[model samples]
Target: MTYLNGVQVSSAAVSTDPLSWLDERASERTDAGLRRHLRVREPESPAIDLASNDYLGLVRHPEVIEGAIAAVRRWGAGATGSRLVTGTTADHALLETELAEFVGAQSGLVFASGYAANLGAVTALAGRGALVVSDAGSHASLVDACRLSRARVEIAAHRDVAAVERLLAERTEERALVLTDSVFSADGDLAPLTELHRACRAHGAVLVVDEAHGLGVRGDGGRGLVHEQGLAGEPDIVITATLSKAFAAQGGVVLADARIRAHLIDAARTFIFDTGLAPAAVGAARAALGLLRRDPTMATRVLDRAADIARIAGVAEPDSAVVSVVLGEAQLAFDAAQTCRARGLDVGCFRPPSVPTGTSRLRLTARANLTTAELDVIAEVLSEVLADARGTERISA
Candidate 1:
């Protein structure tokens, strides 16, 4: 037996075949209903889109498209290099400044994707010997960041403020960070930001909140939950967000204190080593921000639609644009999603390990532009599909 990366493997087994094990793993996943496949979508889909994260429906808006086109015309197709090297353009600098001002942060830094932003922020804020107390339901990127931080990580119960406070108080490390998502991705539930902030303050820990689902839907004029809670400019608080969802663009931003921004610029490996956000994405995001600023009603429209969907689906009102309908099993959830698709509606299916075991669900996202006619169609389709799922469940039992 030999040890590789802390895992013991028999030499005979390694000698037999290295890639063969993957086939067995794949079969196991198939049997467990954990296999995933991608479906190619047409440029102009005929179905009412409930699977996409375009909460504000600005992806193809004339202004957003023009923003991208104009950027490509001016800055070419790519950023060309890492920000520290040669990629930081005037557009990037402008977007960063605008994003900071919008969120009431002292400074902001942009990354190629939200995943990179989360990774950079978490790892940079809490490193070797530091303590990281994260919520159990944080996004996968944040979870991965905790693992990579080389810190003593303690995962508190989901949305349990007292658990987080205990972890912070008991930590041996002098420096600690409390991490959570402002709006959880799967269930669309909100975090207790006020209580979490108070705990962080009492324990002398920094708090990092990922507002991927909160931005453009929670705060006044779509600033975000941090701004809504009046914690925007707090020195101990940091915010990370994605432009892909509500902004309908492709990038991420880390809003923090000026000192933290400078430190990340110097030490965040994902930012310093990875190529900067593309010029087109930066331009599109900036344009989307401008549109939101000019017409804050777009944010309210998304919430109204989400509430309407929740009513139709008989689910609790969502805190954001995402509404989840629990179907209880993977195959049932997949069947319901397919049924909805067949009826001219496209909804998302979530199975384990994306969600906890026994909590498979249909994930639906609301768009601000969905018309009354479209909502009626979605309502009818979901009602029929859910009824069928219940019948099947009763028969199986």
Candidate 2:
């Protein structure tokens, strides 16, 4: 008790100051016209929606909604604990089982989100001595997962199998994990997954493919890119997907061999520590999957819509359900988005940090449920917006 009260402080509270660092960051973003904002939208709003990831348009299906409502009623409002504890419900198990079977995997594990699933898969599989070969154009979540895994990461050029093969040949490490996205999110371009898989096999490395955008847009009956590439049941390949995108629900899943699934269930900290996906999401996704299995037309419709958007908007030919309309500068991109908004259309605006500098574009994700008339309206509004934005840019310059 040597003078314990000597350092007693005053009772008055310290003044709260706004963080200047954050203000500066915000100012920089604003100056670059890259500031983002959220708009409240209603279910049946007249605004044409091309900014969402619901490519298959299953979010508002009667069956999907009913499944969500029923699951909430049956399993309560929330998952009460971590999946390892009291959170895992029958719905979750059913979804996992059905997903594995549909995707031709030996087993599957579900996670709270796609980002979490990627983290869990990457960190668990690629350990301290392992090397992770990633594509430079991969999703941010996958890049973060690689960085967090404490493994040596070599980012090859986008879809460059030759570069990957060269890196793998040079690496002395015996173990490597090659990661790529089946469909690049920003540009909606498909990776040469078949070629990558061959390279992975030649190098004796495991392949981790993120099927986030391809699940309901590619493959036979929406099984996914891996299925299309004939790698679905391969022991050296694993696939990760998000229920939120095509399924219009909230969850992530990893499909792989039975042994790897077991390892994830036991060793993946993200799975152990995070709360399980909601019962409603599980049910909704299950329903959506079932519908996709039965209808199959949903997938084709989405592809058609994406191609239509590209042709009508006079943009680069789309490879999938995402069409990007190039805008020269960040301010022009922002103005184009605003112009579309004013004309009762909703579209995604990509600028620096998201897209590379000087390559700003309007990222439009088309949905299957959108009609031809709606597409016509979208094209008209977008054309007008781009023209107006260009005029404004010329005036400013």
When superposed on Cα atoms, how far off is each prediction in RMSD?
3.7, 4.8
TM-score of structure candidate 1? 0.95
Candidate 2: segments with Cα more than 4 A from true spot: 1-18, 390-397
Per residue, candidate 2 scores C-alpha lDDT tens digits across 1-397 of: 2332576455443224547568888899899888887777786888888999998888899999999999999998888889788857888989999998888898999999999999999999998899999999889889999989999999999889999999998998889999999999888999998888898999899999999999988888888889988888999999999999999999899999989998998878889999888888988999999999999888888888988888766677777788988777999888888788888998898887778898898899989899978987876786667667656322111
Q: What is the lDDT of residue 121 in candidate 2?
A: 95
Q: List residue ranges in candidate 1 displaced over 4 A.
A: 1-15, 392-397
Tell me each candidate's TM-score.
0.95, 0.92
In model 2, how large is the Cα lDDT of residue 122? 92
Can you write out model 1's per-residue Cα lDDT over 1-397, one digit (the tens) per residue? 8876789988665545778879999999888777888888899989999998998899999999999889999999999889899848999999999999999999999999999999999999898889999999999999999999999999999999999998888888989999999999999999999999999999999999999999998899889999999898999999999999989899899999999999999889999999999989988999999999999988899999999999888789998999999989888888788889988999999898889988999999998899999988877787778878877422111
Query: What C-alpha lDDT does candidate 2 achieve relative to the native structure?
Result: 0.88
Candidate 2 residue pairs in backbone clash: none
Q: Give the TM-score of candidate 2.
A: 0.92
CA lDDT of each prediction against the hidden true structure = 0.92, 0.88
